[model samples]
Target chain A: MDRVAVIGASMTKFGQRESWVMDLLAEAGEACLDDAGVAPDEVEHLYVSNMASGEFEGQTGIMNALAHDLDAMPAYSQRVDQTSSSGGAGIYAAWQSVASGASEMTLLVGGEKMTHQTTGEATDVIASITHPVEYKHGVTLPSFAGLTARHYLERYDAPRESLAKVAVKNHRNGLDNPHAQFRKEVDVETVMESPIVADPLRLYDFCPITDGSAALMFCPESVAEQYTDDYAVVTGVAGATDTQVVHEREDPTVMGGVVDSGEQAFEMAGLEPEDVDVAELHDMFTILEFLQMEGLGFAEPGRAWERVEAGETEMDGELPINTSGGLKSKGHPLGASGVAQGYEIYAQLVGEAGDRQVDADVGLACNVGGFGNCVITTIMEAAE
Target chain B: MDRVAVIGASMTKFGQRESWVMDLLAEAGEACLDDAGVAPDEVEHLYVSNMASGEFEGQTGIMNALAHDLDAMPAYSQRVDQTSSSGGAGIYAAWQSVASGASEMTLLVGGEKMTHQTTGEATDVIASITHPVEYKHGVTLPSFAGLTARHYLERYDAPRESLAKVAVKNHRNGLDNPHAQFRKEVDVETVMESPIVADPLRLYDFCPITDGSAALMFCPESVAEQYTDDYAVVTGVAGATDTQVVHEREDPTVMGGVVDSGEQAFEMAGLEPEDVDVAELHDMFTILEFLQMEGLGFAEPGRAWERVEAGETEMDGELPINTSGGLKSKGHPLGASGVAQGYEIYAQLVGEAGDRQVDADVGLACNVGGFGNCVITTIMEAAE
Candidate 1:
């Protein structure tokens, strides 16, 4: 079977942006096309991964608007929505399009515009993805995070200071990523002392509401050879869903979706956790990083906090994670977060991450949606 | 290359229902799973085609809820949205999942809960798909239909009665469908005398806002053979998009998306328009039937009205269209409408349509989104 290759990638600054979703999508799409030296007319499939352009901006069918803006008229277009994992789902969709012979050149743009709405309104939209029975009573994602963090600390006897370290490390990484939202570094003291929104978690423990976009260009490996050799091949990609009702989980610490998707992706790549040299895990909340790390098999249950405290996931350490700062400081723009994760791995694989560069041959990205209601895991490698 | 085969299909009654979107989707999904004689655990991929559950019912993450409701745990799930063509887009996505070897079995459910909202609210949600520039000025889909109907009649010299005949014909066909929203036959006189909605068009000319769901089960030909002997193979499936700005179209009479997607699908099927034995056209409005017929190559430019007048499109005619009453008398549930179109064609090909079945070797369904801003055409054939 032929491999799907990502020949180009681009992303806008992951912070407050004045442009609407369509413009954000078009900006990244055009940059990706230019990066690959491919004409707009060559794109056979155009997919936009957007969660709630309708609810947020009163705009639907932005996929058509994007194709029109990019002069990719007559190209097949659709919107892939998997909540915050939309970008990872877009990658899987693009790979399917190329691998299935349905499209020769596929362009995937994932974006969202949310800063314009007040924080309360924006969080309300984000909260809507939770199970209605839970969300209707004001159980937002932050509440879930706080509850889960408290449980994890009690169950595993992990220190709260370890959670604060995640923020500090990611912020340090973000200082080097020009496109990140927060470019300034913070200390453990700062994150630990931040205003407490939820007990045991503070303002600095969560990703901020952001507006941005990201894109990737995909084609068959043979076709990608014509574009450039500095490309990354997505060796494995898979997604999975767990119970929608979060309370039903036998163990909240064990995200079933993450475990399943990660195992599937690694098996497809013919690799294991030990084989991955670099990684990017969803850090929507500081505690999520620990959960995903444990869920994806980087560490044993109740031991991920130990790894974080050991400096193993740092830039110069073994199996560096979130070299693009993850969502902690890089920003989480719902739909764009997962795509940006892919961009980080793609850049690391292609040796284009000048300042944030880390030695990497195999890379993985784990994107969690709606507190692990769904998750997608993708593994990429350098195309030789 | 192995073919992707649809082994089972089902749909709920297309009418006002008290169930929410999740219930409607699960109703169709469970029925489809049972029809295929497959256990929920066997479904590796589950897709939901929903346009605006959040905007309509303040519900999101429907795909996850559906997976949980159907007991299809750990299966990868995603939501596909292409406005009104969401179901067709879901079909394409499911096919890709199977053909790409991403899944051994895939289930797709397309649905929307709209009757709960007032017509003004429902239409407002639907109109969000149109370009903001036009919709901001109080221009909605019906306004476009009226203006286009007037232009089509004046430009092609087609009679207004020909449009009325569409409503008459579909209503007559709906009389035979047990699950149709409207089962009573109507005469051309009744349609002509209906209250004027958009100038030349009348109230009867538009499909009612409905609440319903439809589903299909797909797998590889090898896998499908183990499940069922009677099945339909999707020979060709393609989608395309035109300008988002409706006025920018070179000619309002020519639906570029319809023509392109139809041609692409036919070519992929190694067939032509003339080879199609039956079809289900998107008749969101009466005039759309004429435009689609002409766009799909059933008639020459400006001659679809003549074919309708000649009775060639009736159930007993040379190439029967809308045997499931299309979206006219059968009801249009936004996302479900396209899936229902596929269901009609699949039923006819598999000898299961009962009263509305036609002698079909090959069938096609054309789904239009946002006034032809995007379209999907799917061609299917009986699996021997």
Candidate 2:
């Protein structure tokens, strides 16, 4: 089978922006095509990863509108939504489009416009993904994160400070990322002292509701050389689902979607955790970084916190993670977060990540949707 | 390359149903698996084609929720949306999943629940796909249909009776579809006398706001026989987009999306319009049927009305179109309409269309989204 290659990628500022979702999408899309030096008409397929344009902007069919805006008329376009993991799903969809000979060049753009609404309204829209059986009982996403964090700490004998450190570490990394929403560094003490949004989990523990967009241009590996010398090959990509009713999980700390998707991705790539030089894990919540770390086999179960405490995941450490600050400090614009993760990984693999560049030949990105309801894990390597 | 095959298909009663969107999706999904005798665990990928569960039901993550409901745990799942053409996009996604070797067995479910809301409320939700600039000018879809119908009639020198006959013919075809929403046949006299909706068009020219679901199961041809002896092979599938702004086209009478997508699909299939034994065209509005027929090259430009008037598209005529009532009488449940169109084509090719079955070895389905914004055309042949 032929491999899929990332010819180019683009990311907009991941923060409150004046643009509507369509404008943000077009911004990243235009930048990606320009970065790749590909004409809009060359794009054979276009996919937009957006969770809710109608709910957020009273707009639907943004994908079609985008094709029109980019002057890429007649290129097939559709929207791919997997809630917050939509960007990851877009990666897999674009990969399939190329691998299946459905399209020779595919453009994958993921975006969301949420900051315009009040925090409560944005949270409600995001909370709509929760199961009604659980949501009807007044369950919100943060509450689930808090309960899961509490369960993980008690069962594993980990300290709450470990979660706080995740925020501090990602924030420090964001200081070098110009596109991140929050570039200021924070210490563990400041994180611990933050106001409690959920018991034991503070305001700093959760990713902010953000508005942003990101784009990736994909094509078959065989023709990638004609486009650019700097490119990353998608060695492996997979997505999996878990039980929707979160309480039914036997192990609260274990995200089955992550583990299953990660394992599948690694098997497809013929690589293991040790082969991944750098990684980007969904850090929507500080604790989620730890869970994905363990789930993706970077560390043994319950030992991910130990790695975090040892600074093993920090820059210049044994294995760096979240070089783009992740959703923690980079901001989680729902759909864009996963695509942005891919952008960071692609940048690192292709030696385009400026100050954040590290010695890396391979990278991985794990995107989670709806409190681990579905997850897509992608493994990429610098094109030889 | 291994060809993709459809092993089984199912459709829920497409009418005003009491079930929620999730219930309707599960209904068709469960039946599709049962029909194919495939276990839920065997489905490697699950895709849900839905337009507005969030706006209509305040629900999200429906694709993940469906995987859990159908015990298709760990099966990769995502939502595919292209407004009303979502179901057709789902078919393409499912096909890509199998063709790209991403999944050995993929199941697609397309559904919507809209009848609970008043007609005005449902129309508002459906109108969200219209371009904002045009929508802001107090234009709804019906008005566009009216204007387009008037233009086509004047340009083609066709009688108003031609448009009314399309509705009467589809209503007759619906009488045989047990799962169709409308079974009562209507005559040209009654349709002509129906209350005027958009000047040249009347209430009968418009399909009702519907609630329904449909599903199709796809796998590589190598493994299709292991599941079912009766199957259909997807010879070709393609989608295309047109100007999002409806008025930008030089020829308002031509639906560029349908034309482009149809030409591409036929080229991919190595077939011509003459080879299509049956077809299911999007008839959201009566005039659309004429436009699609002409756009798809089934007739010369400005001549589809002539074909309809000649009874050439009847069940027993040269081309049997919309044997499953075509959306006009079967009901237009937005996302479900495209998938239902595929179901009808698959059934006809596999000789499982029951009373609505026609003598056919090849079939085609054309699905349009928004106001000719995006379109997908699929060609299927009976498996040998």
Candidate 3:
């Protein structure tokens, strides 16, 4: 079987943008093609990872519209949606397209437009993914995070301040990300003093509802040389589901989907957590970072908070995490969040991350969706 | 490369059912697994082909919910949407899953629940896929079909009654399909005298707004024999996209996507149209049947009407088309329509179609999205 390579990547400014979802997708798609030095006509398949264009913009068929906008006529196009992990699913879909010889070149673009709607409206739309029984109880995603954060702090003998440290570290990293939604750095005092949204988790502890898009170009590894020398090969990629009802899981602090997907990915890549030099983990909420860290085997169960307190996950730390600011500071545009993680990893591998550059050869990204109802993990290596 | 096989198929009754979208999907999914005699735990991937669960039912993350409903926990789940051709795309995705060695067993369920909403509301949601320029002018899919029918009739010197005959023939075939939404046969006069919807096209010329679901189980050919001795192998499958703007095509009467996708599929199968003993065409509109016949090379350009007039596409004719009634009479549940087409083809290949049985070895199915904005074609053959 042939391996898939990421030859190019691009991301739109992750902020409250004026463009609609279609425009944002096209911008990232065109830029990604330009970055890869491939013409639009060369694309054989185009995939869009979007959770809801119809619900957000009253628009459907955005995938077909994007194919038209990119002038990639005749290329097969489809939409891949796994709620918030849609972007990660898009990467997996692109890899399958190449691995199955379905396409010689594939373009994956993921974006969401949500700033136009009120915060309440956006939350309601996102909350639709939760089980109706849970939703009827007025338990949205943030509430789940809050309850989990409170439990983790007490069970692990960790201080509430540890949660705040995650936001501070990601915000500091955002200062180096030009496309980040929040570039200004913040301290633990600032996060601790932030307004409360969901009890134990404050306002700064949650990622903002923003509008943005990200794109990547994929092809068979054998064709990577024809595109560019600066490319990354996807050594491992897998997705898994846990339970739709969040309460059904055996352990609330541990996401089964994350553990299953991560294990499968590592096994495919033939590498352990120690072999990864850089990483991007979905930080939709500060507590999620800790959960994913422990779930991905980066830290022992209930000990991830100690690693955060020790600055072991900073950009200069032994295992730098979220160098692109993650959903914490980069803003969570739903579908775009996961793809943006790929953008950051690809940039780091190609030595184009500018000030956020770290010593990295193998990088990993884990994207979570709907309180860990589903998750996708990807491992990429700098082309040999 | 290992060929993908269809080991099981199941579909719910096509009509206004009491179940919600999730319930409908689970019904077919469970039945499909039972048909294949495969355990839920054996499924490595689960894909749902749905155009609008969020828009229609205010529900999202159906893929995860389904995994939970069917006891298929931990199976990777994702939603595949290519407008109305989503079911066809699901087949392609399932095929890729097995061919790429990413999944040992895959289950795909395509469904929609739209009858709960008013016809106007359903039309509006479905119209969201058209170009704003065309949509603003009140151009829906039926309107496009009407316009194309008018042009086709004038350009080819064909009678308007020829379009009505398509509905008549499909309705007659539907009499044998126990699960079809409409089983009573209709004559050409009944169709021709129906209320006008869009000029030359009448109510009978269009498919209904249905609520239903369909499913199929897929695996590599090597393992298909272990599950079922009577299985159908996907000899070839491919998808293609045309201009999002319907009027932008060079020929108003010809569908570029249908032509491209069908050509690719037939080439991959190493067969020609004449070699196909049975077929299912997406007759979402009566005119669409004529267009697909020409587009798929079953008849010469502008001469498909002659084939319909001569009864060449009937069950006992040279080429049996829509033996399971096609979308025109089987009902169009948006996503479910395409998978139903596959269900029909599989039954015929395995000689389990009962009253609708036909002498067939090779079968073909063409699914079109929007006004030919995208199309997918699959060629299936009886396992040796």
Error of 3 at B340 (Å): 1.1
- In candidate 2 chain A, where is summed lDDT lowest over 10 consecutive residues? A221-230
Tens digits of per-residue lDDT, candidate 3, B300-334, equal: 99999999999999989999899998888789998
The parts of candidate 1 lying over 4 Å away from their true place are none
The fnat of each candidate, in order, is: 0.88, 0.90, 0.77
Evaluate residue A147 in candidate 1 and report its C-alpha lDDT on the 0 to 100 scale.
95
lDDT of 2 by residue, A145-205 (tens): 9998998898889999999989999999999999999999999899999999988899999
lDDT scores of the candidates, listed in order: 0.93, 0.94, 0.94
DockQ of 3: 0.89
What's the TM for model 2? 0.99
| Candidate 2: Cα lDDT at A59 | 94
**Better model by DockQ, 1 or 2?**
2
RMSD of 3: 0.7
| Candidate 3 lDDT tens digits, A1-384 | 668999999999999999999999999999999999999999999999999999998899988999999999899999999999999999999999999999999999999999999999999999999999999999999999999999999999999999999999999999999999999999999999999988899999999999999999999988988878889999999999999999988889999999999999999999999999999999999999999999999999999999999999999998999999889899989888889999999999999999999989999999999999999999999998
